[model samples]
Target: MSSGIPYTWDTDCIRASATCRAEGRLGKGTKHHPLEIQSTTTKKVVYLSDSGSSSLHTVGERMDWKRLTLVFCWLECASAAGISCRNEQGQAVDWYILYKQPSINDENGLVYLYMDESTGGWVPAHNPIDDQKSALAQTLLPLFQHFTNETINFGYILYNDQPPEPFKTASSSFGHSKGLVMMDQETGIWLSHSTPHFPGFDITGFWPNSGYANGQTFICGTYKYSAFRNIAVQLQYIHVYSFDAYIPEYFYPELQCVVDKGCYPKKTPWDRQLNMTSLGGHSFISYAKYSRYHDDLYSGLLDKHLESAFYAKSWGRLLDPLPSNCSVDFSVYNVETVQLPTTEPYSITKDHSKWCVTMDSKLHRWTCIADMNREVSQEHRGGGAICTDNAAVWSAFLDIVNTYQPCQS
Candidate 1:
């Protein structure tokens, strides 16, 4: 593996991918998938981004809501979604997906950490009256309507996921007003990690929602949620981030690792550490393997929830109907049980065909491309996941991850 890529993958994927390239079917990107964490400080935070140009550019705490209005005016949307990251050259980038404000309600909400004395910026959410979603599609969506060829296949949700009261501080970065916490502007990384990805207000525990050691985990995998074939194309770098803010993935009733801690959830067989996603059907399959706790391998039965956490959130809250100014195709879901062949080997879909979207095994919790349209109908089970499917998005995400793999020394 090369130093540029962030994680490792199953040997079989590596071999088959190598074979594909050898057969003139595909080219290669980074090899080693280096684990990266860009240095962040008062001056800069390399790994996160949001609506504000800077991580500190929030609605108000000690400052004014000037910047939010500015973006609201230009981007023309109130609800929006975004990410903060550094490109390959280590340049900080704030990428956002927003919508034009609706005529009836053009105001985007500022999720302040507090009720008064502070306000986070008004994040953008597309307005169906002007912007496009289903029609325009992701890759087809241009970076700028005014003038730019950059595509928007990856920017999906764009709204303020604020924290609720009793949680508000009024003077903190992402100043508390409602139930919301982006990477704290004061702390550096933009919002989005502290809370689990629940439909509304899942950040009851902390801030920097997806940061390391929050009794949560981050899983990465290519999606098979929408269209099967389109997602499979980007098989090399699918990442599904799972956070256990709700409960540690490895909790067990009989395992001694599960200790009583009334102050917190039971002490796990393992203590607080970062989490990962196996992308395999751990939730659906029994006795699979997984990765967790500073990247250690764990039994799937020990922490099935870790690999299965993504399904806990509702896709309805995160997904927006296709807007006009946008050219992006999206799909994501989860279910309790399944109707798909229990015996069929996991595979990635190709040419509109259904295949198993298996999780990468070599790496602990992992991500990979899989079949999307492949629907194994279930009679009485439920789970969920959200994914954006587009060859362009798949390509763009890989490029973005490669470019944003963080500077790990």
Candidate 2:
């Protein structure tokens, strides 16, 4: 479809453009010609007034009207939809990552760490919910408003093993998955997270305080309509959610089972393996649990002869871990203390981040973020992981392994 407006700027110009866009006074420009303001005056100073207005002042100097106009257009579009994750052109992007840090010494509460290709690395978010410039808020605010905006015309499914209080008893066989999906005919996003009892009902605009007690992570990816077909496959493997909500009008035949039977049919043959490509150009492999493939993700991968190591919260079934076979080295990740590349050292417990890394230095490094733990009880449950071999993602996750408990022989 249309890529929207074409404008690019550095960090400083981006901030200024965001301000201009939020105020809604950016002049017009088209793809054929760049933005240009024909002014004879020399040095002109454009600044925002305390009342939040953009004003231009002329001095005895030359100024770049074309550059200024581009900035204005860029920021205007960026601010048009409120605070949202942005691309290099200061336009909204399709995917983003948000990490919630636990309340540590001197830290106030939940701190949001945001990242997109434009920003490259993680940046601290000023506000997670209301900040108009925040990627997380930008991506989520629309979904929150969808509850009241009937004309918005989008399809959504919100699932959590521990759902909001109203619909807790809906499904007991669902895997321990927490996520939400919102889409239309063209594009949409899938937000996979580790927080329980979250995004609260349409009425509650606040995050549950309990989520702040430990470290949590969320990954949101925007994808073309075609990608949802693969997503639907993954959801089928997840079985069901503790609580789920979907609109029948948006259901494709593949996903109609969710709306009709409350879950996929018991006998429906589904692919146990899938490769999902995100809009951001990231690739992930999803492994589903079914009939002969009853083994856990690590063991299943091991059976294929892929050697790897895993890191997960050890509270559930730490003692009954899968042994390290000749090809795979499975282990439990311990985080008594964590030192990450982007943040300071902090202690955490009950961290729900499920991920693993291949340890074979000779082989291509592989990293996977999953929805299930390594506990014995979870072996029987249906869940999956999205794996990638991106080095940056690998480095970011690898640096956090302070210690691990190796599997017994």
Candidate 3:
């Protein structure tokens, strides 16, 4: 029911591990952001709070609920079981996690995470993924859809010693990173993808140790790829992985596929092409939503919802064909100017995925799993390398957007 300025509410939870599956009691514990603003002007997110603690107990005690609509926060994990270990001294054996790794919503319509197995001392007791109340939300009272949960296998991919041309289907077309799903499916050769989707994750968990903790990016609409952006995200480099990689966050409602109950949620990767015609843009579809994501959609740097890295078919490099040709060209379709990526200060570029808000347009900056770890995110090269000639937005744009609608009871 709350909108404008700052969204305030009463508080938080923790994950059993990196995934959203709550390890401990998903209880109604603490809170974050007495003043949380998703700045419409600067488009830059700014969070102002006096508390710098991960104690859900303490956060809930001091939260002012009249301020915001949602409360987003992060907690540190101790093991694959996602439990923070109390040492012989009855305290969590402290590890230095720097950043507050963000929990994200993604196009898949499922909230996924690969908890870094290195965060805590390996306690062989249990696996956090199945823990009823993950570290996420404390109160185990079934809160319906606070988050969609799923476990992911974040591990290594061995490039075949002998190179083959590329097989389209051989590629992991779903949660794509650029290892090489097959340069040309027709040729059966691998292109060699090196984005975040390739490398394995910690499963133990990362964050809240050495970096800044700003879990405020959890808005109502988005998709979560992997949270390991804080880890190594370089295409040129090998073994690029994440503590957790956060990809395209979607707003649950945008997904148009329906269920037996007659709800139109989106489909997963396996059946994506079979139902390719159903793939469209945001809920606000004025004209045909066209992009390289499919034969029909082509939204180039259109909005926050569309700007993403290259296709999974290629390994994080520019999706081949140099200039992708969307099925609809200017002459055939009734294409009018909706929202242009160039109108906002948002940035964009070749390699990496994130962009900064610029003067006129959203210029994308090349980023990878590494940008999440390093402080300095490099500026993208100008014209030569990066081009959106005939590109499309995210394939799961609608699905990711649908995950956030208040889940039904």
Give lDDT per model, in order. 0.19, 0.55, 0.20
The residue-by-residue lDDT of candidate 2 on 54-110, one tens digit each, is 434345455455555544544454444432334333456756666666656635446
- Model 1 residue runs over 4 Å out of place are 1-162, 169-265, 271-396, 405-409
Instruction: Point to the candidate with the largest lDDT.
Output: 2
Say which candidate scores most in TM-score: 2
List, residue by residue over 1-101, the lDDT tens digit for candidate 3.
Answer: 12232222222322223222333322222124333222222111224333443221223254344423323432222222222212211122211111112
- Estimated TM-score for each candidate: 0.18, 0.71, 0.21
lDDT, model 2, position 128: 46
Clashing pairs in 2: 17-75, 21-76, 42-61, 43-61, 43-62, 83-132, 83-138, 84-138, 85-135
Q: Rank the candidates by lDDT, best first.
A: 2, 3, 1
**TM-score ranking from best to worst?**
2, 3, 1
Lowest summed lDDT across 10 adjacent residues in model 2 is found at 1-10
After superposing candidate 2 on the true structure, give the runs of residues whose Cα lies further than 4 Å from its correct spot: 1-91, 105-108, 118-122, 128-134, 169-171, 201-206, 242-244, 248-251, 265-271, 290-293, 301-337, 342-348
Candidate 3 TM-score to native:
0.21
Q: How close is candidate 1 to the true structure, as a TM-score?
A: 0.18
Between candidates 2 and 3, the one scoring higher on lDDT is 2
Query: What are the per-residue Cα lDDT tens digits for candidate 1 across 25-116?
Result: 22122322211211111111111122223212222243244533332211211111111221211122222111111111213211111100
Candidate 3 minimal-lDDT segment of 10 residues:
377-386
